[model samples]
Target chain A: MDNNTFHHALKIREDLCIGCSHCMNVCPTEAIRVKNGKSVLIAEKCIDCGECFRVCPVSAIIIDHDDFNRIFDYKYRVALIPSVFTGQFPDEISEKQIHSVMMELGFTHIYEVENGVEILVDAINKYAEQNPVQRPLISSFCPAVIRLIQVKFPSLVDNIIRVKPPLDISAGFIIREFAGSGIPAEEVGIFYVTPCAAKIAAIKDPVGESSSSISGVINMDFLFSKVLRQVKQKKSDTCAIPTSGELTARATCWSLTNGEASQLSGRCLAIDEIHNVIEFLEKIENEELNDIDYLELRACDESCAGGVLTTSNRFLTADRLRNRATNRDKAPVQKHPEGFRDISSEKQFLEDNISIDPIKPRSILMLDENMAEAMKKMDRVNRIMMLLPMVDCGICGAPSCQALAQDIVQNNAKIHQCIFIQKILEQKGEMSLEEGVSVMQDIWGFSKTNKYRDLKGI
Target chain B: MMHFEFPIEGGNFLKAGSASSQLKKILKQLNVDPRIIKRVVVAAYEAEVNVVAHAYRGIIMIDIDTSRICIQLVDEGPGIPDIGRAMQMGFSTASPEVREMGFGAGMGLPNIKSNSDELSITSEVGKGTTVKITNYLEQ
Candidate 1:
């Protein structure tokens, strides 16, 4: 793969795949196609939204993450967890208990990912104010949504606020804090417990920015089980685990829907789910929507709470986080322990480094780089569409009829791949039965095509 | 060149911008510059909405080639009595219902003019109106 290509954290287990088109049918970007008894992912078109992972019936789709033992390599193992991780637990599990359990599980320190939100809120508003021309500045909070814009809605790339998200901001702060304490950066490892594959991709192949501050990624579900198992086994103990600063009510719910939009001072709108975001962005691209200052878009329906790696129900996790925020607002602030350090002290450092380089648009819609060639290809695609059936049966392994047409134009697929065209060719003696079976075998594997005996009853 | 046509039902705010949306998809597939696509779509959408807000019915005709895209929206309804005044910003004769739906901002013509490379309007009072917008592919 080229270095410039997007790094996807979602992977398909070829050994376990049944060539089921479920993932292909539900993919928001149509990045998956079935071939040779397995679903193949088009890396360039995939945004790592994990929609395919959600729809995969056989659990063939898996998210790649850093090994849990990798954290032990460094002297200081810091687990940067989002609020949703704790939201997976019942209310009886206190935040301190969660932190203590994580500390027992080989982490030297525990930090809330939303701690960066305090610095980020001000930077986002300032960015929106500074760039008045880019109306309805889209949030860079969701990595999946950022990739969605890069691939699908390329024109709106400029409208995305050029700022690091809370994950990176918190990582930057923690790295600085470690440095201030005379701890070498190499000795400190900050691993983000991510709730989605998109975050893992973002950390591995950062957009706009040259590199990510976080060292490694640990999937939320993996860590949630580890922490929960320990919490259940051990009784509450007063173990003084070094922890980061507390999160405000606003910051606690910052990863939830409308969290950032509610803080920004303007006519802002919060939209979640990949399809809903795409629909709204289409209108925004067409200039149908106007006079909006900010837009908060998340790929998952309930924001981070609905991330693919989440173990709890999306609504319940969201409700729990909201309740936590409400309780935090009403409760009195408690004194910090001896090892607790306020992240606000590094606010100036974070704000100074908040702005990232401009994000470039990598449009996947075009057939070719050259305009003249693309126009020719599009004309050919349209002509091909006239011949193919419009039913979008997916027997051709493509998501829709239009997709197969484009694939044919691009030479990635054959015209006869369409079952409708195959039947016509067979009827006209233009193609042999053996040739048709071979094509089917090539797309669906020989087992599926040679299963005439299994279909006797049906 | 590729030619396409879509019929726009007037006074139907629900279906407004459908034509422009289709045109935008075609331009995207043709590898048009993002800036140019934005201009064409904005102008096309404005014209489409104008027909929906003021006309009884309209048909949008689009002609595209490697060099430029030309769009024509012809509608049959109350035509512009004074084209020059209508071209001015904040000048609208839209009904109260149209304004209520946020369609009659009086900036439609001006917006289309700014976004399109060439914009021409021909109308006969109480008969019909025709809007032609052309956008170049290259800067």
Candidate 2:
């Protein structure tokens, strides 16, 4: 019944969705139900993997970022870095130097997500020992994956290792680490530099997890560029600029292509491309992949590196990261604050949030009549979908043939929206060029987001 | 007047998660709260799905009353030989196909057990399986 509490991290513009069923099709939990005319993203089941936003070429999907000005109201500000970020920079930018950059960025202190990952790994490793020889343990690294499993594969909810994501785990530690710092948790703002929409959505809709400790999110695209510009303009190029071999890069790397999950033991496999991940998760539902010990699935290919709104290119950025991570000697060599206190209670820690709640399902699915009507609509969709190839050519805003079907039922779309279908018809002398142009304009609706668009108006 | 049953086939990847969704729908019509409904549906669905994934074939029985909701999943599929061990968190017999859909977390039984106010399982290896779950109202 809590499915009624479905809250979306991002809202879909019916005008922008283009009836593309990509989001619905790739959602891990099957939480997305295409009803009416547009995509109905079930917030209860959405893992916030940001897969939909990434898959949408129209740049229609977006995660709202926090205004840095809002932090000025706070007495103190801090930046939380994921451990995977340790691999994002050059050797000159040592860990301590990166901390200095926080000072450079008007933040009083900086915390590493790696510290959280280490502690979280310890907790999970402890849990694994108690339940060895059971089912292969799944990594809890991905909050989206964890929640996706929770709502969609509640049957396997127990299978989800009782651990939290690096960010949540780390943020909790920071609070605890700052307990006696003379700064109140409320007075101090700890902003996370997010790589993808999942973390932002996770902040809003946490699953198989605990309350978020993050105060707010700053997209790396926004934060990194400003920091880089500030550093460049400072004329402090040769000052060593407080080098950081940790964070900013390796943490980004950790989120790369399921690298962090590979660190865990079990029948594990990683899936990129939300659709593939969804299909894989479904198999897990049907009792397939039982022997595979660990599954490290990411909605985006190259995992977090392929995050929708990052400033870096997937291939080039990952290559640069590889260079940085190789030089770092791992933690222990990394520096820590001289005097820091944690501000969180053990009861409030992310690790303590593994308990599952059972309630009566208050799902407001299609009423009997609604279902019948939906079924009829679905049949029409099916017929149209069959006529179109499944390639999801994206000639239509919809990613695949099925999305066109969903759009058709919603009445917001038509079968003629598909260019491939039109092309097929044209070859068969069923469509004319003029008709194709009209369908093209109708399929991929134009957005005024020319500011965010690339050369091709993506 | 109000009953729903989905024929669950063993090893059917595409068919998996069907019963859970159906049961969820039925519970929804009962005017259950969204939070409670999600929990019940997810738990009941997990158990039902396990029947299809881990067991051979099974019947999922659910009864919703004014006081409480009860679900009994009886399967002809091979029963769990070690109920104690199987009950542990992260234990699973799911196949690769199930894992692909992210259902082989081995957390199924533990989730069902933890979520429900009352749960009982009786099974015999190679014989069959049965799982009973009761979620009392306001409990």
Candidate 3:
């Protein structure tokens, strides 16, 4: 019996697809069903996390995020730069160069996504040491993967590291740190210089509503090269970025080697590559392993530095980062920059991390039925799910065929979305064109008559 | 009470979650509270994926009763040798390839234990493994 879990609401554009199959390979849900040499996203099962958008080389997968021009609406613009940027350009290029370039790009000031990382690192370290019963604390940095776990791997949802992601942790800081000053938090716009589409999606549609201090996205791809040109002329500071530089080096740049997350012990389990993380997640989902005390997962295999937008060779940049980190002065900087390194406002940023309503997903009233009928329908749904392929292509506008089948089971959709149904009708060679058109009208809820004759496209 | 059995394909990672999906729909239509519904769904799905990824072949049987839901996954594959080791948090035998998909973080069994009202398992190295998990109705 086929009783596939489906991911709904993920889609792929056939017109735009290059058939690279990267989406097929990378899909954590395996919901993309390839038919007629193109991909379809089974809608029922897709988590709508947008992993496909990042890996698509031809820019085939699409999402609905706004452009960089949106920054103009804000009076005070601050950039929350992802640490992955340090690994993007050649290592010799100083952090000051990177920061100054962003400063040139309409951002009034910049804060390290690294500092947010420090907050997360400390939070996870403290939480893990204290709550020894929680097993391995799964890193919360990968939003797409985390969302997949929420919808598909609910049991593992609680297993997700409780600390806020570096991005959100930093956002919390941005709010109180800046707000503590005379500037109102609402008036100050925080923009994330993003490395991935997942982060952009996360900022817009947040997980756990941790109040992503980020207001909007300025994609690194659109702004990086322009920022680089500005950086080339900026002078390096020997003493200006000392404390920030020491902490922001190497391990801060990208996915650490094994035992990197738990620097306390090299024995900690480390896995990079988002796809790989999903596999481990499934293992955890299937009751295969749970003894791990720490699981360090990097969405990008080489870590965020391998982000598609970056310019430098990933290997070289990682190497240079390593060199710089090791060379860092063991001696403390004369003093942590008192002015910019603001902590007085941190008191306000320390807000409740726990969700007020953990059980809200079950609060919906629509999911109930009688015993006998429910069993019968369960059997029927399993039988119907088998005819569809397991690939989770978004072509059907569902994340996978299994998800489409879920919609069918829920009465939200029908089996006709499978594309094979139309093929079967064509294969039968028994119906007239008029009969087919009428069938389409009956099932598709549309007719030859225009719904809006005055519409511009029509 | 009638029992419905699904023949879960072994080593078929893609189709693993199907059984759980069917169970979830049934529970949902029965108007099960989203809380209880989720518990049953997660338990059933974890066992299903285990059958597909690790077993040679298996049958996922779902038995419904008044007070709780019971799922029995009986498999013919080489069963886990050290249940204790297998139950260890973050201990996974899934290959690097499997690791790529985020399925083998070794959190599955512990997570299942955490989600269910009761969990029991019996297995022999050469024979196979059967896991019985029950989720109480009121939870």
| Per-candidate local distance difference test | 0.90, 0.62, 0.62
Model 1 spans > 4 angstroms off:
A1-4, A236-242, A333-340, A453-458
Index of the highest-TM-score prediction:
1
Give the per-residue lDDT digits (tens) of candidate 2, residues A412-440. Answer: 56777776677888999988876776555
**TM-scores for all candidates?**
0.97, 0.58, 0.66
Instruction: Sort every candidate by DockQ, greatest first.
Output: 1, 3, 2
| lDDT digits (tens) for residues A331-432 of candidate 1 | 845644744377778888889999898988888898888877887898899899999879999999999999999999998999999999999999999998
Predict model 3's lDDT versus the native. Answer: 0.62
lDDT of candidate 3 over B37-120, digit per residue (tens): 766777777777777777899998988864678999999988999999888889887767666766777877887787789999
Q: Per-model i-RMS in Å?
A: 1.1, 8.4, 5.3
> Which residue pairs of candidate 1 clash?
none
Lowest summed-lDDT stretch of 10 residues in model 2 chain A? A359-368
Weakest ten-residue segment in model 1 chain A by summed lDDT: A332-341
lDDT of 1 at B105: 85
Candidate with maximal DockQ: 1
Rank candidates by lDDT, best first. 1, 3, 2
What shift in Å separates residue A428 of candidate 3 from its native position after superposition? 5.6
